[model samples]
Target: MKALNATLPTQGLLNFKNLVYLDLSFSTLHNNFLKDIGKISSLKILLLSGCQLSGTIPAAKGLCELKHLLKLDMSNNDLRGTLPSCLANLTSLQQLDISSNHFIGNISISPLGTLTSLHKLQLSRNLFKIPISLLPFFNHSKLKFLDCHENEIYADIDVPNLTPKFQLETLDLSGQGDGGVFPKFLDYQHKLEYVDLSDIKMKGEFPHWLIGNNTKLYTLHLPSCSLSGPLHLPMHSHVYLSHLDISDNSFNSPIPTEIGVQFPNLYFLNLSGNGLIGDIPSSFGKMSQLIKLDLSNNRLSGIIPQDLIVGCISLFNLILSNNNLQGQIFPEQANCKELDRLLLDGNQFTGSIPYSILNCTLLNMLDVSDNHLFGSIPGWIRNMTFLRVLDISENKFSGTLPSNFVPPQIREVYLSNNRLQGPLTNAFYNCSELMTLDLSRNYFTRRIPDWFGKFPKLSYLLLGYNNLVGEIPIQLCNLGQLSLVDLSNNNLSGHVLPCITAASNKVRQEEVGTNPYMASSPAYMKQPLEFTTKSISYYFQGSILKYISGLDLSCNNLTV
Candidate 1:
């Protein structure tokens, strides 16, 4: 039973002589509940996950007496210290899960090595150090699933080449150690369906054999594994494969042109942060089931293939930022209506915002900054009612700000360094959810609006290098969440309001929530907020933006 605040009576539990199963998950149990629990020798399954259990597992007459326990789960607790030696007495345990705990010690000498009947073991997010060779579990012929990620599992120079007795169906050893080699034991694992070896310093070429051998494999994540050389695919198509992420690697080859034909069922693909060159494969259009595709931060050039844009019907969250890709932003035939977050910044894309993108009605965050695009900022952007972040800065767009620019849900608007002119309008007064408004280095000429104080969540306000003229409004003091304010290089004349200082001091003590748009996907578009402070321009993004508090009224006619 979960969410029950009732105290677990150890005496009452011990009276149940035939209690074969007991689950107190997410319950608030007394610390002494387990003192007499071991008396229930008939318990075959015990689930105490999220029970708020703390300290070490009792080693005396607690869990050790449950010799007939076939399954035990104590995950998501504060349990720590070495596994009790008496735990090895549970020889019939087929499944044991102790993940997300503070348990420490080496697994080689631990009780897990003796649990030969274990078919499923989850020890992830612990402080354990396991041997890379996995020699201790060689005799566990019945084992199939083992997840021990986020630990100190390391490699040894003398790792044995002995074959394992069991064929794993799922294995996750990601984030085990740094400067380690690829697990050689995987060569013998043919029944693998899910594997995650990410964040381990395993330096090697792409393991094509992984897909060739494990025909049933569906998910393979090897991001940040120090893999190099050409990323070779299997000799034939692997229809069962779906999720694949090999991002943040050093693969220095072109993406396989026929990758779509190879893993046609892939729903998620991330090959970002690699050195891959050549044009994006047109075959990607054939992957009808694809949902999220990230190919950002590469040397890939040439225009985005039109076929891929129109064919990937289920596609969303497409990130092709920080690449050498050129040509129009979106082809007229672009039909990916499910697109949500489109990040095409830091590229050479030309022309104004395409109307074809309007088909993506679910768009939330759109970043096209640092491009060669020119023309008036589209006013139809308001139609995308779900839009939260709009970044079209560093372009040659010359026009006045649209009267009804963004949607009411807009949280961040970055249009700095563009040719946009004229006064800040009342269009932003309705954007109550706005958090960051960066319109720096534009040609806008007018008074700094007093209604800016209407935005309750406004944090970063950058209006520097504009020609606006007026007094710094005291209404700004109403923004208790104001953290960073920039009104520099303007013609505004006035004494620095003491209330402005009060607002800044108030924000310093106040905690701010993360920008919802930027927080959506950690690997997606990270729109940086540029502000000049202390005569230096710094770009802040992600979590670091929250703590960045500053006030820039420099180069203005403001007095102390």
Candidate 2:
């Protein structure tokens, strides 16, 4: 619903005097809001979100006149200036969301509390800075939801004395939890259901009292909260918690085998980035409703039980990378028909790719790299019609490429650092979606495939440290999206293409516009970009690789 760039004609709405609800959200409307907008006396719901509304709400006298307003959403606009003092006059305003704007100044939380009817208030992602004392002013008995996340609201609270009167259903303080500790006051609110205290810098045991004390909660996020000790879930607490994240903490404990029994209804669970050891609890299979489970970057070992997640048929993403987990990939996971993202890389897992995994046809991202896995590449991998990102690199797999080794939907292929001896195959030449191909440090012997230059989205072509012998294929110059090219330590000989040499010196204008879309994220994320800088193979990961493009052709028998 796009509006004219010119000022909104409040007079135009004057004719709709009986209008009870006016929603012009995402209308792309521009210019200062008209004070005359207050004329819409009957407006109970006014949503101008994403309308590109700009400038100050200096005199919202017209809006203030809407004493009957029940909901007003003006978020995702360019509105600035202090909220109008007249706003406190909307005694009937139940839900007021003015987040994600440029609004600034000391916003007094006390004035809004006058509208005792106010149940939800969202002030996140704005530049409002004020006293932590103003928090108490939000003690409105009816207020149930308050989100002041990602703001500069400082802390100066009397935690012990302040008992919130409202029974909050959702409270997301996360980065804005002013005080470095969990607000002990929350311990008094038994009605709190959704709570996010992430990055609060809390120490010691997990805040079991929070959940143990509350009746129930739907989501609890405590990532980077600096809490440590064994994670123990109260069996009687949180029977309805659907989402839980405690990543990036110092948790050191065996994931309780009773986790699934306790969180039978959990849909999302992440316990990554800790010192959790022992096998992934087989009891986790009891969480039949589990959708996403991330236990990556831990010290966990032991074989993942094939039936560990066989019951979680709804599971879509299972990430267990960077752990000490061993044993063969479980075929029981094939029962999860919705599986799309599977990351078991950087672990100690061994054995050939499970043939049964091909049973999960919905698989899009599969990573088994940096493991002890061995055996010939599975030909059935092509049966996964939707497979996109395949990383089986850094292993001892010895075999030649299957006729159709590359999945048609593949965006990135990481088969590097393996004992796989093979010649370049044209079977994957037509995989138009192929972007990053790293078969480096292998025994692959053959002239560089000219098809490398034809891959429309190919960004990083790393075939370095191979036994390949011959001139560098001039067809490589045809890759308009080529960024990082590694051909070092090869037995190839050639007069380098000027186009390929210019790549390391300056980004081809076409290449710059093609990279971001080359490899869809997660798979592209954290994938190392290895290139020789001053004769040293430097690795760039994460967002830094976006700007670091190079070409490594040294140590090759080839002459440029």
Candidate 3:
């Protein structure tokens, strides 16, 4: 049906009772059209997702006639209202999805045990303030899938202790309240797999039975649970588990070597933001199917095993930030040709970036900041055309920055706090898409580049504590998008341009906010992007991190 516009006539659809399938999804629809569709009693399949249908789905009025609806999808729309208990009348419903709506109010009248034929039900991403534990009923044998996540539903309640008659394949209860213990009822569910219990705090040891008992449980996530005590590596050797994330907890233990011997098919593994100590195990090398591996923000020491580079041939993302790792990065990393995003910042990694990095031509984001690396900055970095975000700050590297240093698609560059000395290169002019640039606390000589004024998206320009001499580049005033300007502690001798002052005056509201491009403020810079006042430094975050902007030409030979 050509239902692309709201002008489509629905009067004829009311007379068509034999129409068994009707889908008006992905169209500009109105409530009037929906009301006419309800008269078709033979509609076994009805899909109206993304129809831009506003207001609420009329409750228990016309839709109640579709007793033969086997599948009904009204997700991804503006429809909002309370839980419609009238859905209980659709006894033939095998699938009913109403996710991504503005539905609110208590779901107290849910006809749970009544719909015996209902199999798959989805009500995720709604505004309903209700208890999640009361969703499933024990007698519902045909019900296989039930998802009611992210609806403010798991507030203080206890899951029923009764044994489930249905064997569920997926159970997601993320962001839930305290569950005193692992639901023992799931122990009987050997067919259980793909469970997500992330952000759900529970008291006691890790649920080892989930691995030792149910070898079929493949995709499991228990992050941010705050569960205490040492870690326990599962003894399962034949399980084909592919995805596992137990990050952001107090699991104090060394990464077990048996991980490679067990889950050789692991595609995604994130154990970051935990208290994990000791070395990353060599077993990670066995994960040839691994695509992403993040063990950052922990106490893991020692070097990344080179075997990982060889075994995990398909590895793309490798984030090992905020650890105590001490060693030179291996040049063989380039052997993993599919590697893209590499983050080893906030560690003790020494020596220069391996020249082998150039072999990994598809590298997108590379951050090795806050390390003890010391060497002349590599010139070949300019050759990585796909490189976007590069941060090698807070190191002892001393030398001239290569000409044409910035890649075309580069968004952010942080070469701050180094001994680098030379004329500030105009390579930055090539970064038309640049949003942030910090070359502060260095010995860069010569005048600041005038081409900076030509940048269309430049917001931050920090070049403090340098030997840069000459007048304050008045051309910089042309950057109307400029927000933060820190040129303090330099040999600059010129009038403080009034346009620069006006640019700084447009502070982006007084608040510390979240940056969309970054995980947190610390990840964006070696330290908080600070502004000094009276020998004290205060930092900011988000798009307004430099919102309260000001020219810091302090201790400079500048005139008013």
Candidate 4:
């Protein structure tokens, strides 16, 4: 039972003498709900996940007395303290899940060592300090799945190379363990299908042998692992491999040319934030099933392969920013109909924005800033009804913005440092959901629009370094959510509105879950919003952006 706000009486539960299964997940229950639960000795499965339970597990007679229990799940709760030692009495337990809790203590001294019948165990996101060697479970021959990520687990160099009896199918110890070498026991784990060792400080070259050994492996994540050298793939193709991420590592070589052939069925691939160079392999065009591809923040050169753009028809999110890649954005034959977010900022690309991207009508975010592209801003951009963020700043684009430029659902628009010149249009007047609007360092000439106050959710307003001349409008004070305002380098003449100052002081609260265009990964919104203060430019994004509050009226003709 879930969301049954009513309190469960301990006496009423005791009446079920033959209750084999009982699930009280996501239910509000009394603190002493489990006080008399052990009396029902026939309980085989007990699930109390997301119950908001707190404090330590009850006494021995409460839960440990359920010797017949085969499955126990108390995950997604506020429960803390050490696991009861008496839990070993439940010898029949096949599955035990206590993840996402505050439970502490060493796994070796816990009751898990004695639970030989366990087939699966989840202890992730806790305070447990388990040994990286996994010596405690060496005798568990039947165990197939074990997840203990995001804990205080550390490496013990002195531990011996005792082979584990069980061959795991899925093992996730990411975001745990101390700085050391890769786990030696994995050398014998040939049955592994999914493995994640991300955020663990294991300095070494990529383990090419691991993929050769575990041919069934489908998902392998080793990001931020201090890994060095070239990313080497096994000589033989791995047909089952799908998701592979080795980002934020020190891999300093060109990507393997046959990567697409080795893993042709890959659905998601991320190799960003490395020192990899050379051109993106044309073999990537072979992976027709690829959906999300990220190769950003690398030293990769050469133009984006035309075949990869046209071949990957199922692509959704493509990120190739901050690279040395040059040439036009995409080939005229490019047709990625399912593309949602595309980031090509901080590159050496030339030529105007291509019309080939029009096939991606489902676009949500498009960023091509800090490039050498030059042309008139396209008016067809307004046709992207699902678009939320549009960043075309720091380019050579010249000419007036399209009369109907604003998208209906646009939230953030960045058109700064361009050669565009004209009066500010009323295209954004109906954009009530707009949050950020930047038009700085342009040749636009006109009075600050009073209609800007009509946007109920607008937070940042940047219109600095323009030829506009007029009095600062007091109507700006109507924006209750306004956090940062910049009208600097203008010819405005007027007294500063005290109401605008007061509104800036108010803390800007972010509407977290209300975003309709939220991407599946945080990489989609990695570009920061730039604002100058005290003669220094500051970049803000994510959580830090909400805390920033300031006003810039410098280099202007404003009066006291």
Best by lDDT: 1
Window of ten residues with lowest summed lDDT in model 1? 516-525
- Candidate 1 on 1-560: residue-level lDDT in tens? 54777755556777889999999888877776665778788999999998888888888578888999999999998889999898988999999999999999988889888889999999999999887778788889999999989988677668766898989999888875864667788889999999998888887888989999999999999998899999899999999999999999999899999999998999999999998899999999989989999999998898889888998999988999989888898888887889889989988999989998888889988999998999998889989998888999998999888877799988888999999889888768789888889999998888888898888778789999999998988888887777788889999898898877765565443233344433442342267777887788888888777666778889988888
Backbone clashes per model, in order? 0, 4, 0, 0
Candidate 1 has a TM-score of: 0.92
Q: Residue 98 of candidate 2: its Cα lDDT?
A: 89
Number of the top-ranking candidate, with TM-score as the measure: 1
RMSD of 4: 3.2
Q: For residues 34-116, what per-residue lDDT tens digits would candidate 2 score against the true structure?
A: 46667778889999888887888756576778888999998998888777777888988889998999988765543564767
| lDDT for each residue of candidate 3 in 104-206, tens digit (9 for 90 to 100) | 8765556645777868878788886545444445666887777767766443365555776777777776755665555666676677677887877766566
TM-score of each: 0.92, 0.87, 0.86, 0.90
Error (Å) of candidate 2 at residue 446 is 3.4
Instruction: Select the stronger candidate by TM-score from 2 and 4.
Output: 4
What ranking emerges by TM-score with the best candidate at the front?
Answer: 1, 4, 2, 3
Off by over 4 Å in 1: 2-7, 28-35, 58-61, 425-429, 450-453, 473-480, 507-525
What lDDT score belongs to each candidate, Candidate 1 first? 0.86, 0.78, 0.77, 0.86
Q: Which residue runs does candidate 2 get wrong by more than 4 Å? A: 11-47, 50-56, 59-69, 84-86, 105-110, 129-138, 176-178, 212-216, 331-334, 425-430, 450-454, 502-525, 542-548
Ranking by lDDT, best first? 1, 4, 2, 3
